[model samples]
Target: MANKIVVPIKQVPETKSVKMDEKTGTVIREGVDSIVNPLDLYAIEAALRLRDRYGGEIVGISMGPKKSVKALKEAVSMGVDSAILLSDRAFAGSDTWATSLILASAIRKIGDFGLVVCGERATDGDTGQVGPGIASFLGIPALTYVSRIQDLSDKLCRAERLIEDGREILETSLPAVLTVIKEAGEPRLPTLRGKKRAKDLDVQIWGNDELGIDPDKIGLKGSPTRVVKIYRPKVARKCTIAEAKDEASVGPAVDRMCGFLADKGVLQ
Candidate 1:
């Protein structure tokens, strides 16, 4: 098997509580509870399973604020051999495309990896673009919605992917990237020993300087997609309460209610 595998992970604000910064066009993370993107846990599990079967090093990598280090630590606790954090003010406000570039650069710096795994999508973004973007940046083959792996060797791997109509089996060369669906499997909880090791092991932090990424290819400055404006669409509803005067009038009341609903374009 290849010597190394990289799993790209993300930490996102809880879906129910996520807020965006209108001024900056970025997520407002302060005072929000964050968790590793649920889908990414499956990717991590897939990496761990691959290592178990193929004998390779597994590394978890993420690009986010310093708080993201916590996500990486969690991955280490889940049996990742090591973790890397990409953090810097220069990386703030990156969209999926720029984020992928930064991550692909970091992976390139890490060198010699046979596989890269990532979640099908991030809860906060729901764009499902980063994985393929990373593959594009790295110039490698990529597979999305992978649900099962049939075989894995040092130079090649084969897997089943879920598609719109059904599923398809695919085989690809090594050094490939796979974006895994949650249906692939559940992630294992961290063992006590793994937790202790995670606490003791320092996660290496890399920045633009370390990865030598071009300033024009990272952060808000590099993001091609822009949020020109963000506003809550107003919701307007007119409520008409109908009450029947008595059983004798119930039929008339029902007719009136239906008429009101029809006037409101709620019924035919």
Candidate 2:
């Protein structure tokens, strides 16, 4: 197994502040504070555990604007050995496919790596596709929804993954991708030393120029899927209160509920 492990993370708007542009069908990130994608914390924790058990360097990578360096710094503060930020205007508005392509290219640039760990999905997109997409681009096995790592070696990884009805164990060769789940473990908080190191670390920045990926296969231009429309579902309800202070009012309350249900066609 190689001595290097890569964990891909994302910066996302705080859940409560997330909004969408109905016209553009995109997230409204302006004026919103962003944090490291919550699920990705699990991925980072998993990588850290692996590094602890076996000796390896954990590298955190992210693709976004220059400001996204904050997320990388946060990852460093969480105990990653190093971090890289992929920033370029050419990478704006990338869909999952385009994103996976960009990240896979970066991994190739990093050269020898034994494993890639990622979160099950991003909260914003919630697609759960990038991890598998990276595996597809890298021509490696993709084990997703991983809950636990049972064993690991230079050549192979055995893990437990969640399925619809239950969990199943899977063994895949090295140089594979694993999309971890929350069951892995809770993420650790950053320490004072880690924070100081993060402040001093010079995070490397790479772009399309460095990765040399085809412009036609990146950003919005390369995306095959598009959001045509975005709108919030309307939720409207009418409340009717029938007081049953004593047994005398119980019969009327039941009759009122039945009538309301019948009117709504729910009692048919």
Candidate 3:
């Protein structure tokens, strides 16, 4: 049997278009449009491509508010074999560690999945920490910032990870976690058949109690870090434009700048 690949995604508020309250520093997400994260598209595409090549089922998982089903529907329309949404009031305000613990619990419930894939980070949080957090919670090997996944034989999986200085190639056993960056591949368009199938396909929705996660440890209570405040940065610009009409004026222009700096004590 081919290995089953699972990809978990999220629907986040379009922070790009969101306006914040300058006084409170809280996003005005109410009535704002939500969309499936761009990075998650790469993870979903990777799973589908692996399934097509290796002959397995590609399962899509997501966590968010009740409205987040829209995100999974989009995934289903992209040819995922099945979709699961984890939703509940208790899941609100969960940080990376708590969120990963809840997701890991759901993964265990699904059972028998050989590989897990995820995006490098979510645009909303920009933490880039959940993928590795999931791996740590599950005690599985995780290779993140993967730009390329070369091979996925049941024998082994080889991938190239992008680092700041260069790339690192890694090989890991089956049942490992792979976190893909957007550069991994261009996601495929949703097919008509896939859209039709998604119409009737009911995505399984899991709750905190159903997944058997410790209530206290799977939500805000479990998060250690809290943002004391959030604010938009204010930037001040100081620029000088210099012009020299002829070669003779170049020396004078340079001297003018030097004099300005010297008078300001910027140059000693």
TM-score of each: 0.92, 0.90, 0.84
Better of 1 and 3 by lDDT: 1
State the RMSD for candidate 1: 2.5
Q: Residue-wise lDDT of candidate 3 within 1-268, one digit each (tens)? A: 2357889898877866766555444344557898998899999998887887788888889988777888898999998989899998787767788989888888888878878999989987788888888888889899999998889887678999999999999998878889999778899999999999988888889998798777788666667766667766887878665678999999988988898899889999
Candidate 1 lDDT over 34-150, as tens digits, reads 999999999999999988887879989999888899999999999999999999999999998999999999999999898899999999999999999999999999999999988
Q: Which candidate leads the pack in lDDT?
A: 2
Q: Model 2, range 1-268, lDDT digits (tens) per residue?
A: 7989999999999999999888766787768899999999999999999999998899999999888889999999999999999999898888999999999999889978999999999999999999999999999999999999989988999999999999999999989999999999899999899999999999999989999999999988988889998878887977788678899999999999889899989998
* C-alpha lDDT values of all predictions: 0.92, 0.93, 0.84
C-alpha lDDT of candidate 1 relative to the true structure = 0.92
Clashes of each: 0, 0, 0
Name the best candidate (by TM-score).
1
After superposing candidate 1 on the true structure, give the runs of residues whose Cα lies further than 4 Å from its correct spot.
243-255, 261-268
For candidate 1, list the clashing residue pairs, or say none. none
Ranking by lDDT: 2, 1, 3
List runs of model 2 lying over 4 Å from the truth.
233-258, 262-268
